[model samples]
Target: MIYKYFKECKKLIVLITLLGMLIGMLFFITKDTPPTLVLKKKKINIEYGQTYYANFKGLVDTTGMSKKEICYLKKNVSITDNLQNEDQKSYPAVGKYKIFIKYNNKLSTIQIICKDTLAPVLAFPKNVDVIKESDLESIDFKSLIIATDLSPLKEIQIDTSQIDIHRIGEYQVKVFVEDIYKNRREKEFKVNVTENKQETTNSQNNQENNVNKIESENNKPNEDITISQSNEKNNVKDHLDNGHQQTKPPQMVYWYECYLCGLYVDSNVSLEDAKKKFDQTKCTDAIEFSGIEWRHSRFHYGINHS
Candidate 1:
């Protein structure tokens, strides 16, 4: 009976030893195997003004990983890029950048291409007026526009192909602008070209005629009827001494006179009438009249009241 019991114990011990060896081999075979890192994509595209996250979740999957391995990856994963504000999640500028993700001594790379899809902004008037036969070279088109963009401007072109300075008609003008990123913007406005009438010539001529008439009156001789004039003056003095008060005529009051339009008006003229005359004339909107001053020599020309 003792011999039989020893034999069974020896067989049981051998079976247990073989089972332990198999388990050891399995552990050794799988010990150095790395955890799989499944990535959704290896490349990402973001706009110029978009934000990028440092700890972007769902980009890598941690499924089938042990609790310890997942914790290690979460703690050890790091992302590096050329962004200035990497901690703030905003892209610095528009360019292509390579992002390095490292976890557990393994590195993964992703390409980020920052692109600009927005166009430039333009602000300009809808209607413009140009004088006929104007000097086109003196006109500064840039001063009349306001352009804005995130990138530097590449070009600003004014298309005045339809405009004719010598012609009296309306034309369409276009302004085209572009940025460094190939973003473009276009704006259009109407330019009116009108007849260039010599409006100030008539006023100047009228003033010259009035001056000549005044000079002639001042230089006129008093030899025609001197005795009759003296008698009339004596009679007027006698009438004044007799306590007869002679009423004086009201003084003429001139308000404004536009040299450009030959519009001469007194205080009796309404403001609306002056505006109508201004509109009817070929004078520019900048022309206006101010307080008048009298001179014995020449007329005071009106100035620009814009």
Candidate 2:
């Protein structure tokens, strides 16, 4: 009986010791200690050139083992954190990057992908001209513009209703090609508009001057003699043989400045009753007028000039 009692006591003592060891192991691992680290990102979906936040959700530490290193392999980044807090993520390139968050010996890793699959496009030329009076009623002018972005460009509108320019201006517009990824590239200056007619106010002024000049010439030279068609041929031939070019030839007088055509040099005779002084001669060979300018020339007929 005594021996059996002793054996039972020994077994009981051994069992107690084993249970104590198991309990002690538990205390060593779970007691007064930071658990493990759990790092989380605020969003899984993000765009290129976009921002995302990372947060440390759970962590436990007793011996300052909570200090962790964060790293991204693709972007050559390294960061250190002391608590379960926020994290920053950036997609600077086009590819997948592995993200790592490690607490001393414990670690968690994820993949981040950056992508670009879009092309940039031209936007607009809205109002070509600002106001009507600023430009000639017959002249063409400049336009205003706008630009925008949609997944792809659907339409671009240009207002040309006011343009009277015969020539069209060339303008470039951007067009985009897009994919599921929001990444973008640019193809600049792809559309154009050009004005068809070259406009010049100076030219129109010359025409007006020519008309006024012709009328004034009719009034001033009324005192001069008109050559009879019958005698004019011989007289002209005779004059030419004498090496005398007609003084009143349209070439010699700027038509745009003409104000004395049929008038005699005496300046006293009336044009309706005028008689010839240079009947066998020619009119003034050269003209000098005040503040005068010439416009243009045209082909001459045997008797009249255009």
- RMSD, one per candidate, in order: 26.8, 33.6
Q: Candidate 2: where are CA atoms >4 Å away?
A: 30-45, 57-98, 105-109, 116-145, 149-306
Worst 10 contiguous positions by lDDT, candidate 1: 297-306
Q: How many pairs of residues collide in each model?
A: 0, 36
The global C-alpha lDDT for each of the candidates, from Candidate 1 onward, is 0.56, 0.33
TM per candidate comes to 0.49, 0.29
Q: Which stretches of candidate 1 lie over 4 Å from their true place?
A: 1-35, 61-73, 85-91, 195-306
| lDDT string, candidate 2, 47-95, tens digits | 3433223333211112434323222121222233222211332124445
With candidate 1 superimposed using the best TM-score fit, by how many Å does residue 17's alpha carbon deviate from the native?
13
Q: On a 0 to 1 TM-score scale, where does candidate 2 land against the true structure? A: 0.29
